[model samples]
Target: MRRESRVERSTSDMAGGNRFYFPTKAPESPAFYTGRAAFMDTVDTLERAISHARRILSARQLLPVPDFARETFPATKPQWKGMGNMFNVVGTRMRPKNYKKITSLLNQLAECYNVAHVGDAPSVARATKNVLDMFGRVDAPIEDLEGQKKPVTIDDAGRAYARGRRKEASARVWVIPTKTTDNPSVVMDPEFFHEKILKSYRKITELPTTSVLINNVPLAQYFVNPADRERVLRPLKLTGLLGAFNVFALSRGGGTTGQSGAVAHGLAQALAAHVPEADLILRRALLIRRDPRVVERKKAGRAKARKKYTWVKR
Candidate 1:
């Protein structure tokens, strides 16, 4: 929450006088604007983000229906705080000020969720949690102060899936840092994050980063050596390695590569579940959307598209 007055360089480094810090975590995409809107209308409705996650996962059962129906969406103190800040940043970019749009988007997401999961309760549960985790505190389309609309068309499910894919790819990529024993700069090969204290959600997606964040370690670190992290934290996270059956892998999809990448993304995502600090590890992996199309060669092909036999210019 700390804001640096000027995230800038020295005068010599300033060309047109522009500098900024990229927030470690960005907001969810606007594809789910409806849910974002509804979530914003109220503070305690903060739970709406959670509820919306369920709704998108399973509208009929996963989602909790309020005891009473309301004529209009509810608004609360936090909602006002967020909305006010929203406009301050982009100024009129999040226009139309219509929360209904957000609700509609949520509905669409729910519909898509129903279709995708169909009957897997566990996956439905996972998706619900994933949705909430990704957007619960993230601001809405504040950038849309101008009240723009990204209509949900027939292809929106596909598009939304792609957006999700991009986030998984480029978001918080983690690289493992091997300890002195393993080679400090080297990505640790023996370390494992998901070997125990886990279930279906536990999947070894990629090699973890060397550096890690332990929520309970900060206060104690001021008095102890930083190297203590290995003796303390690593032992706790990698306890699963004691067992025999385990394998590590990398995967991505939905942006163009398809469902394989999606699984890798999901596997990393599962590791991050319930453990925010673990996210920093996966963040080191730079996964993201690749170019949609291949580049064309400059040379003229005498035969097929790019292949040409050894031919004479006669």
Candidate 2:
């Protein structure tokens, strides 16, 4: 045959060698992707990872079983609620835009895993490391939910005690079911009663009337502002156990607002202790967590915190 050009010879040889012929190129580096493309790719990868994690956690019994069977009262037949609110207690209901959904999912899984494997230190540690690795991937700071909080306990005297803080204020609170024999006559600040609150107490026939005593003073006298009184009573009001329990609080540090908030926090915890079911409600209301905010310290040049000294033209 007449001398074929080098390219023509190679092409014919490649074509004749196989039914299909294609050029192979090196894989594109991640850095070559545009910002949007990179972001989209990362999101997709993370979404897949989240699904994988859910499956792994479910297999490990660290997530709630989706199809739990509940027995009907009269029929006593096991009924599947059909995926039945798997995230009723934990996990986010938000759409997966960025990291929020995945963050909550991983965090809750980690918590459940930690709680479930408390005795198995080696496995718990490994699981924690894996969870932290996932959190790092998402640039999230994982909460230390490993330790199971001690279950709220009741004293032999039927009282639940809890401590709470807000700003610089701290409070020690005790809650007890109102009883027929528990007398309020010995209170040091008996003159500081609120008539409206007392009226509400009287209206509660199903449960004994509730009373609030702060430092041996009636709540009304302890908090002169009606708003402060309301803040202190909010937890009880939300639980609809306003007149069902007695609250005794000893508050120290900070101002009236802080003290009221502290007492409210303590009251919420105490209520949660007394009524375990109310814990979820209080948690939803964010009453169980301590307030981390405080009065910002005054800087050297500032008049008060961020308030700058009056600027004047030279």
Candidate 3:
């Protein structure tokens, strides 16, 4: 009893070569055999694929590689973000099915990684094939499509014009670059300024100011509702072209809401025309399309479009 080393104690417990011994202190747990094995396998497969793709994509000097390290599962956001940027650069022309499959696979991989790390193997195995497939094709080249549309061009007036309609409202919008102005300075109406800026200054004396006019009135003054104002400015804001152009819109055949919507649609079209490159952004935002919804006519016997009066037995 003077001293007994761990090795000696372990050897004493396993007296025979045929029998195995587990120390009392080292309690047996299913996690040792079940969770870690599959988790490490899945992670290893994914990590290898990711590394291989990264090496292949390293040739793209402009694309920065995502930071990936072993056991960094908890911090996978940057990896996904980096992957997204890379995908944008090379996945635009990828077959829709492939694109969707790859996206789903990445999502599954993230989910499976989390679940597997927590000792759930069955759940993680569900999407293993999909995740592997995604990792395999992460570096594939995008295919080119035929007959690409030509970019829109600005007119002689240096303005792009578009028409938009919403409900009974219709609008004609024109967008012109602020840089084309011959005047050295532009005098803006007090109401045109944002509330935050308006509170600090009586008047703004600035060059190359963006102006939005609706029916010869400033945007803020015309669209009193904040929602309406936001709707009118959404296209520009989305394109990061806000305050870079002058917008003139003539809206008719609708109230505030309709008119605002019409102007927004028109503005979006005009912006697309001015900056042909931004057409994709405008299209995705659904700002280029004319809203087809209109008010349904009231039925003669109904309270409103589809409502009927409650029956009262006499």
Candidate 4:
């Protein structure tokens, strides 16, 4: 839980700026992690960051450490408004499919040592309501046939357990949300990943409304050549969105797939939020209208949950 600073801390009258404490892995590995020098008023930022790092560095006593393709990079806590104040959590896709998990998130209303996060509490409540309501839309199990209103509420949670379906939406939502990470130390959470990654992924998979974002704009040139079809997929069936209309998306982390998914997902959600009915079209088109939980993580994970698991072609 404690790491000694390796990089030499320094300050100079030449550049005359905030002091910095950069860190590196071991001598054998490439120094993939580093941060800019900045002022620190509290240890809160660094402590929160290391909590996640502790899980990654050795996986601790929680769950098995996921096998990411590359070394997990520790984030540099930057100085940005409303950045390090709240916890950084990754959004996930399992909620719709897993009610127990949804319930668990709802039940976790901040335990011992974890005081009330009222703002976050409402979010969790809303998510719980959504999953429970949507479950009935597909698998209605209630036979009450009497007391029911328009939009469901927390009181409806218990009923959902019986009904087995939400009164409104379906659980098959092409765009599933999964909370993947929670780093409280980060300053600027690149909006590309925090906002738009999953929407793009769902759009590609569901084929509802077609959207494209170049995350790796640098890779755009490959599509220009047309031969890199290997890299930039051409229009096809299973290749889904990855085939046709190559979207260029460039991002720092959460992996290449995560970045693409976020862009596609965010785009779809935006369309739905602004244009209401567009979501139906998107779902029909096979591009799932994102559930809008792309950035909020319901549960903490090791490094990035999706990044792990080395490839196996078998």
Candidate 5:
């Protein structure tokens, strides 16, 4: 007696006139359904179970399924086509609780169906790792953690105010626009004066003169050194807004150098606040930076910071 081939048995199992004989139901056990139909049926069952779980969880208000998951894993006919795409059904808004529940259900289904035999679907271990990695991430909130305050202030009189510090010295400065009628000085043109009377009564508008007062004293009297005077006025000259506004500063502590530097810094910030357009220029020129340098302290074995004792071999 000779054994029959698989083709001969399949042909004989078909109906007399029909070309196909579809199974009414899936195999009882996972091992029996190891073909394409088995894989498609398993995928379809998992999809249905997920949908049902989502509805139940949503109705109970336990876990609300995200919109992304619904859009990605829409209900479709059970077919072997695109079975591998089922692994892409991760939810975007599922929190930790929902993630745990869904993953647990997935693991249970994988075990029941022996999903390990289906090579097309992602492995249960890999999917679990990916899901855990994706949902574990959290975005940080954006905020000003340092609580820094602005350097400039405005007064009721429309004046720009600022404070500056340098080496134990600090200055409070205010910049205000100058009024044309404040000073009625005339410019004497040589040509007109020479042709007419030596002293004619011709009133002409003169360039505005910037007046800077420190502690109720004139800037010239306060800072005797020409270099100190220039340092304090450098911010105005650099911005080409000299004589555009009046500066009233109150500086104390430290010597002339520190006081001048502090006043310069304050004036720069006040100018930036008043003009608004010259902020970038003043910032680039480094006039707004507070000097961080300080006098070095004396060491135990040295007279000064690095000045050591006289070398003695004895």
Candidate 6:
């Protein structure tokens, strides 16, 4: 046989030998040529796969016809719809015509029972009339229930009463008006025969002096502090009624300061009661307001309120 040509020999050898031999006559590098061919083949395969998938998707768009087996046996009606009006359909359905008649009968029965057991129409009319008559009998205004339409007035004793409190101290105070004559009358008489002439009759009016007593003791004696004494007397001074009335206060509880405040509050109230016009003045001066300040409670693990115990690591 003639010597085999290189191309044919290589082709036959490749067909008979291992299928993975690299070709020598490739123009570009073998690795690049093989990779390029593999990439092109892969691109073709992907395009074919995409086209096939598109065809399947287009076919799926058409609706499926019902099978003969399914058409032979149709679905049954829903149980709820079949049950119909036998079951009451509350809010969903229109009320039956008998509902109105039933409600009317119930209302009539209730009215009849009320008339038979409670009373007849004429008796009801009489009861209503009685109520109207009773309402008509009330002639006085309802506000009169608060007894004593007028402002608080001093009794025949000429004393005004009031109560005051400050902290733990409380005082019951009474202010009494004092009577004083403004002028004095004197008359001299001459005796004719009798040895001694009768002493000339003289009537004198004295100026009233105001005094403040606390628990039956003088204010000065009860309250040692000058400030406390001044606080107790502040209300009278503010109202310009210092010498007008004598104050007797029974104060209990709390210290001297609190007692003084309590007494002042009581005196203010009494002054207001004594002279209604002074109410505005006393209120403006804040004498009528009760002091709300109190001592803070001591917290646990502390020496006193807000005072922490000293820590010493020994």
Comparing 3 and 4 by TM-score, which wins? 3
Q: Which parts of model 4 have CA positions greater than 4 angstroms off?
A: 1-219, 222-250, 284-286, 289-314
Candidate 5 residue spans exceeding 4 A from truth: 1-146, 181-205, 312-314
Candidate 4 at 71: error in angstroms? 52
C-alpha RMSD by candidate, in order = 26.9, 17.1, 21.2, 24.1, 26.4, 37.5
Quantify all predictions' global Cα lDDT against the true fold. 0.35, 0.64, 0.63, 0.30, 0.63, 0.58
Kindly list the per-residue Cα lDDT of model 2 for residues 1-314, writing each as its tens digit.
Answer: 68876776687788885434357775464533554444344345544554655566566664553333222112211111112232332232323343454455445444434433432435544654454453333222234223225556789999999898999899999998877424322121223234434665654344346789999999988899999999999998777676668889999999999999999999999888777767888999999998778778889988888998888899
TM-score of each: 0.21, 0.46, 0.43, 0.21, 0.46, 0.44
lDDT of 5 by residue, 184-249 (tens): 111112243244334654454454557999888999999999999999999888776666778999
Poorly placed runs, candidate 6 (over 4 Å): 1-152, 181-207, 311-314
lDDT for model 5, please.
0.63
What tens digits encode model 3's per-residue C-alpha lDDT throughout 216-288? 9998898889999999988877776766699998999979989999999888888877666778988998888
lDDT assessment of candidate 1: 0.35
Q: By TM-score, is 4 or 5 better?
A: 5
Whole-model alpha-carbon lDDT for candidate 3: 0.63
For every model in order, what is the number of clashing pairs? 39, 0, 0, 57, 0, 0
* Per-residue lDDT of model 4, residues 1-314, tens digit only: 55434332233222365545436446432322322112121122333433443343333222232346113422211112122222222112223333343333322311100111122334433433343232222122234322232321212211110011111212211221112222211212334343544665544333323233343344444235434333222211222322112233333345344433344443343333333344465566444433333443344443354454455699
Winning candidate number (lDDT): 2
Pick out the ten consecutive residues of candidate 2 with the lowest summed lDDT.
72-81
Deviation in angstroms for 104 in model 1? 26
Residue pair clashes in candidate 3: none
* Worst-scoring 10-residue span by lDDT in model 3: 183-192
Displacement of residue 277 (Cα, Å) in model 4 is: 2.8
Off by over 4 Å in 2: 1-149, 180-207
Least well predicted 10-residue stretch by lDDT in candidate 5: 74-83
